[model samples]
Target chain A: MIAKQTNQKAWFMVLPVFLVVAFSAVIPLMTVVNYSVQDTFGNNVFTWVGMDWFKDLIHSERFHAAFLKQLMFSGIILLIEVPLGIMIALAMPKKGWGVPVCLISMALPLLIPWNVVGTIWQIFGRVDIGLLGHSLASLGFDYNYTQDPIAAWITLIIMDVWHWTSLVVLLCYAGLCSIPEAYYQAAKIDGASRWSVFRYIQLPKMQRVLLIAILLRFMDSFMIYTEPFVITGGGPGNSTTFMSIDLVKLAIGQFDLGPAAAMSLVYFLVILLLCWVFYTVMSNIGEESSNGGK
Target chain B: MNFNWMAWTAPTASFFGIIFCLLVIMTIWELKCPGGGPRIGILRFETTRGDRLFVSLLGSAFIHIFWLALFPGLSLYWALVFSCIYALAVFRWV
Candidate 1:
């Protein structure tokens, strides 16, 4: 697949993307790094703090708890959404009128704003007015997200699943759609079982898209803020608070800029590391499979 | 049996209702025009009409959500405006 000519002109085409990333990502990231190493006390006063913020953050119980909670949230979501999305994509109508119908319906949940998603679920899960809350209450379950940590976690998880599972479904559907008809025909000719067809044909073809889906979902969920902020406000006693929420409370709420900035860098590094690991592992598996097929 | 028309007035319910209506319209449109050849867009990937619609809808949702979150006291009319623009751009270019 290597190009016959090594052309440098391609860099010109990439300049816009590079510029946008520089301004939007790199500048703010540098500002965070600056803030992470300095102490500020109003009136434009500051003091150099070195790695003190990072040191304190590393030993902080709150940070550890939030980190663990964040991990758990992402873990649970990937577990539920990936398989669930694939199954839904599998069941989706493949042709004619059903294609658009299935796509539009599946895409509907994803279109709502994050906060609006929170608002919708907030109202939807209220004991007095929310349909879910009312039904659960009528069903004789003690489900109060406002007062119970377990209930709050469940609500947040369900809200996220409702909000994001569509992304996975859409990615998987695109992957499924891209699969050639010849594969199906060949499987039919060979008398392959349904599971075997999925395993050998569909799964292999979907590997690339699934990798993208997992990475996107992982990063988004790890940095999730607004929806949970709107729905539970990181409460029932900080039960649903993840790292981003904690960072915001530290930086904005208490104005602990140094520690918050340090935490942010750490958070960014963790995500980068994990995504790199995922990419390496998945691509290795892909290469191995292709080699084996040869 | 009497239907609950009042239930349809809620924002969430109305959102779902609008989605249902859109699905019906899209279904009819698909039935009328049965095929959509893939077109390459800005992403340099070939996408059919359904893929374009998915991207547009998803983009619109994010636009609206960000609007709501960033500007709490303001009305959603601006968000709607931005969303429409986004949808148009996505359909045309992506």
Candidate 2:
């Protein structure tokens, strides 16, 4: 299937995509970079500020707490969603009309708008009229998301799980479906148990898609803002104020553009670094598993 | 018969209810024409009907989220317009 000569003209096909990305992503990122190194006041007055904002942000207790909270939230969601999604995908019906039914149902939560998801939980957690809050109260539990920090955190976590586990499920299901039928048939001929089949065949095959799912979930959860914003509005205290929320509060709420811009660059870098680590580690594990199987 | 309709009228309920309806419609459509055959699209990968559905739904969700985030005070109808166009393109090409 190798072509005799390499054709360079195919690169032209990708030009439009590159242009769109540059305009939509690169330009605005440059603007943020510009703001991160400069101070501005009324009448568009600007002053060079160097790395002062970044230095301050590094030392700020508020930034540290928010960063830690963001880490905890992302860690918790990944822990819950990845395993839960795999279980759900494993339990799904493999044949007949049930496959589409299951996929559609699972995908439903993911299609809803994020702010709408936030707003939904906001109302759904009202102690007076919301279903979850009311049911919890009737069951003799003290549940007030607006007043209690623990309850607010729990609500946020639950809301995130409900909204996002479907994504992981869908990705895992796709991975499962891509596995060849001959693998299962070979396992059957070898009298392999279900667990062994999954481990030796399905799990290895799913590693790539699983990595993708983890990367996406990590990035999205780390940058989560609108959902929490609409739900607890950063909570009874700053309990749920993740880095993104804190940046928004600094930029818009307090009009500290320079610091906010610097914080955002740091946030973006953190996500990029974590994703690289995840990709490298997961790919190494994938190689090791494949080598061991061989 | 004194059930509180207000309880069922919440936006969350409506959003979920709409999703359920979409699922039902998709199920019925699948029943009418069972579709698992793979076709190559713009992505140049073999994909089936379910894959397209997942991509379109996921893409539209991001489009709506980005739309709302970028233009806070604007009506979501504009996002809906973009999402619809995106769905059409996905179905037609990918």
Candidate 3:
């Protein structure tokens, strides 16, 4: 009903996407689901264990701890990046050569791979070798991620902020750029302060992009793996071990397929549910905007 | 959401077992009407080979490999490097 009219040409447009998702997303998901259900020992002997793994995973403290850590991490990152990105976006020059420079510099961090981001920070936070750690230590701060749980958490959070704030900045910048000159021009004639203009015009305009930025960052951060793993190895203690790390430990570290699969499904569902809530909120704003336009 | 354990297990097992069924159904849909796919990054190139995708990945891999060799017991870095190369290639070729 949603797509009642046939657009045969659009199928061509959609074909490549379907193939890629099928190969990557769908297939892997199936494998994970498969692993979740059945019991296996060594080479391919999979006995039907049913929902045993799921039950164990759901009740486990490890899973709960990881889930809580994930929630906290997402909440903290979104709080930091969204507001910081908005401020940075607002401060950015709108016209002339400054635009390109700001845009390019903002985009540079985003181009770096997630693991490399971890590596960069790993090297970066070394007291003897790296800049930040050395500077902090010079100022008499005890900075050692290898032995300190607090330090590892801080390092991972900083690494994530460094890598992903660019995304929020770019999205907010796009939203800012989309505001017609007339709005600002009229606001100017009415003698609006910078705060008033930003509050009335820029902030509302950015609602959609901000929502997208939040949802994307939430889901990615919730499902984060490589960066923290590379940087701290979920280390010092299990303090920073998020859900994905727990799942990986179950599946690969302990070779416990059943529990891991179960946990992965639950993890997947949590992400999906959060995404739906975020989606509903975003769409409500979009609907309100369009209705106002009408 | 009632966990009979038995009922939950059956559907869960069959859910995985019927994998080829869904794949076939999706393949049919693909045959009839292909729609969204993963986005590919299109880099500008001066040459026809346009092996920039491979080149960029190998360059990244080289950096990690170099780091791994220099730092004893840091070979786990290569796993991330390989995953990156795989993701990029998937965006390119798959």
Candidate 4:
């Protein structure tokens, strides 16, 4: 059923969400803004600084590299996970016992904490002991993520793919399931090939969910840490450090509160900006889709 | 209370903030997804409200504590085994 059209009073249904998001997001955000504009000693005493931290952060090579690395990593993750997830989801059974088993198993990786996902892969890729590492080494390959830059990057990308592709799969599956059976019946009667049927029918139906999946994955991957931090510790030589990793190091490790806060606001803004763009684009598509149906 | 408005309060505040957000999410979810399971997925393996509360709390606790209590010499594989056992118990009994 279309969402209840009770004179927009239904927005009250969204009240719980707003309260939660505001608490989780707004307070910390206010603090981050406070820090970004000021310098402080060990005590609660604070001194006013201007845009100095933002200026310094903007010019920092380390921040630039981390930012570029995050952008690239997010791009790569989106490219790999979205299509692969769609393919796997397409292969899944629509009905019967297999459907549930497959969906739950795929989701298993996602339910694991992000830090643990990293640790699992860290162990899973150990050349001496990790399943992937040991298998590769036994098969006579020189594979060491700790020492090899390419291997480290590959391991991280693959680990991410394994962990998050299920989210895309579930979203796509929901979209697919929502397609009326009449569309398939119409296609069969019209003698449309299976490939044509999928391209014209299923893909269009899934666009909004896929857009959400892509956008969520992009933001999350761009800011990803905890896992990579546990696994690679942002090293061999800064190869795996994303923007979020750099932010944590600045804020907590070095205690450079001013610049860290600056970077974080920028970081959060970048995510918000991208999400807005994605939201608008998807809404347009939804509008067009509804228009088409009429 | 003399609230140390800057440092000591941030972590605790953030933690409680997460809980409050999650509670609101749970409530909205209960309204939206009434009659238990989400619109998609298996019902037999479905987590009830009690099980869901247990899983989220237990999982988060594991995230915080797993690094602390590992035996000094235990292998990563052993740790994984222990985690899998924990997941099983949460899944089956929680």
List, residue by residue over A73-95, the lDDT tens digit for candidate 4. 99899999999988887888999
lDDT (Cα, 0-100) at A283 in candidate 1: 69
DockQ of each: 0.01, 0.01, 0.03, 0.05
Report the candidate with higher lDDT, 1 versus 4: 1
lDDT of 2 by residue, A209-263 (tens): 8999999999999999999999999978999999999999999999988899888
User: Which model is ahead, 3 or 4, in terms of TM-score?
Assistant: 3
**Between prediction 1 and prediction 3, which has the larger TM-score?**
3
lDDT of 1 by residue, A1-294 (tens): 986876789889999998999789965776676677678886555677655676677768998899999999999999999999999999998999999998899899988989899999999989999999999999999999999999889999999999899999999999999999999999999999999999999998888899999999999999999989998999989898899999999999999887898889778777866886677567667767777878
The most accurate candidate by DockQ is 4
In TM-score terms, candidate 2 sits at 0.73
Q: Model 1 chain A: which ten-residue window has the lowest total lDDT?
A: A42-51
Which of 1 and 3 is ahead in lDDT?
1
Question: Clashes in model 1: which pairs?
Answer: A111-B61, A113-B65
Query: Which should have the higher lDDT, number 2 or number 4?
Result: 2
Best by lDDT: 2
The all-Cα superposition gives candidate 3 an RMSD in Å to the true structure of 16.1
lDDT of 3 by residue, A1-294 (tens): 496786689889999999999888976776677777687786655677755675566567887788999999999998999999999998899999999999999999999988898899999999999999899999999989988888888898888898999999999999999999999999999999999998878988999899999998998898899999988888778988998888888889999887787777777766765786687667667767766867
TM-scores for every candidate against the unseen true structure: 0.73, 0.73, 0.74, 0.72
- Winner by TM-score: 3
